[model samples]
Target: MAQNAHGGSRPGVQPVALAAAGILLLVGVLGFVPGITTDYAAMRFAGRHSEAMLLGLFQVSVLLNILHLSSGLVGLALARRIAGARAFLAVGGALYLGLWLYGFFIHRGSVANFIPVNDADTWLHLAIGFGMLACGLLISGQVGTGGRLDTPIDRP
Candidate 1:
């Protein structure tokens, strides 16, 4: 097997993790853009009062964007190895699930919603959480040596 820059086998790299990381990084960066993130001038450091919305859908703040960027960075760093990538997805997915549930208890436009999630964000979190978890559990070893999905084409 060919080794990558991270000293891991090229096939060990997880595509799902990379895609997740890329998405997060893109979203994070987009949050800072004025047009992409509406009400850019109203974005708060970390609070529900922030009026900024990414793609005019999901509410965003400086802190939330930072969190996304950080998560994406972690995913990228971990994607070099199969085990590390799976751990990242599993743990990150759980955290997103927790965030999703947390959004339920938070009242709209209340200080308690420091994470500043709206209904759109809440449902999106559910989808994202489930997706990440499924990818972690079911897709974990697909890219690694003799992975569960791997079958020798030369075999009779």
Candidate 2:
């Protein structure tokens, strides 16, 4: 197996990062599609005034879509290395958690709602945050002999 610069074979971390990146990229693209994003014409560059909702559920603005695209690109770039992939998942997860909290606390239509996150977005952020964090911490390890030790299931 090819070893990454981190001196370990690329294991579960890369795939998790790639999956997350692909989702982000797909979401960003979907946000721009007319039927997929309801009230498409009402989409604004940024701010709570944007009336667009992805799948008629999550509020989305042009700025939010761009952020998703950027995050996907970053994930793709970082997935090249084991350490980078771990960092992407962990740090990205933390950021998503923070976004969830921000969305939950901020009143809609307020200046603080610049990201314009809705209830759907808030809950989705929570899920993504915990999911990413779990993937980052639980899945990381070297492949083969250098990886985590596995115990026999039948061992008492």
Candidate 3:
């Protein structure tokens, strides 16, 4: 098995976690940028009143950006271990799925829509949930007992 810089024998899960973390970090940072996030001045700390759109697509606020940044940081920290990476993916996926449902069911202008999620954000959340869940489950097979990398089974 190939060893990663962290000395982990399983390289698959770590890379996935790292990539996801990097993307989250980038999106979070872009939300604060003027051009990247349109109507930057209109961004609120939280709630439906925020008019800021990240990449002119998904709605965002200071709270949402902070969530993304924190999630990214957590992902980066968890990527050091296979179990931690798997947990991050699984738990993160579930959280996104829950958020998607909340956005889908909640009225857009209602106070319950505290995240102020739009249609695009809801759909993106759905995709991210499935993608993360799939990655976590698929990669888990490569993890052996005691959290070590499992050798591929030989075929006749």
The residue-by-residue lDDT of candidate 1 on 1-156, one tens digit each, is 444447786433388888888998998899999999999999999898899999999999999899889999999999888888898888889888888998877898777899889999889888888888878887636544654443598567
Clash number for each model: 0, 0, 0
Residue 19 accuracy (lDDT) in model 1: 88
Question: In model 2, which regions exceed 4 Å deviation?
Answer: 1-11, 144-146, 149-156
Model 3 C-alpha lDDT per residue in residues 1-156, reported as the tens digit of each score? 455448777647778988888888888899999999999999999999999999999999999899889888999999888888888888988888888899899999999888789999999989988787778777753544344445577433
Pull out the clashing pairs in model 2: none
- What global local distance difference test value does model 3 have? 0.85
**Which segments of model 1 are wrong by more than 4 Å?**
1-13, 142-144, 147-156
- Candidates' TM-scores? 0.84, 0.85, 0.84
| Positional deviation of residue 135's Cα in model 1 after best superposition, in angstroms | 0.6
Cα RMSD, each candidate: 6.5, 6.3, 5.3
Alpha-carbon lDDT, every model: 0.84, 0.87, 0.85
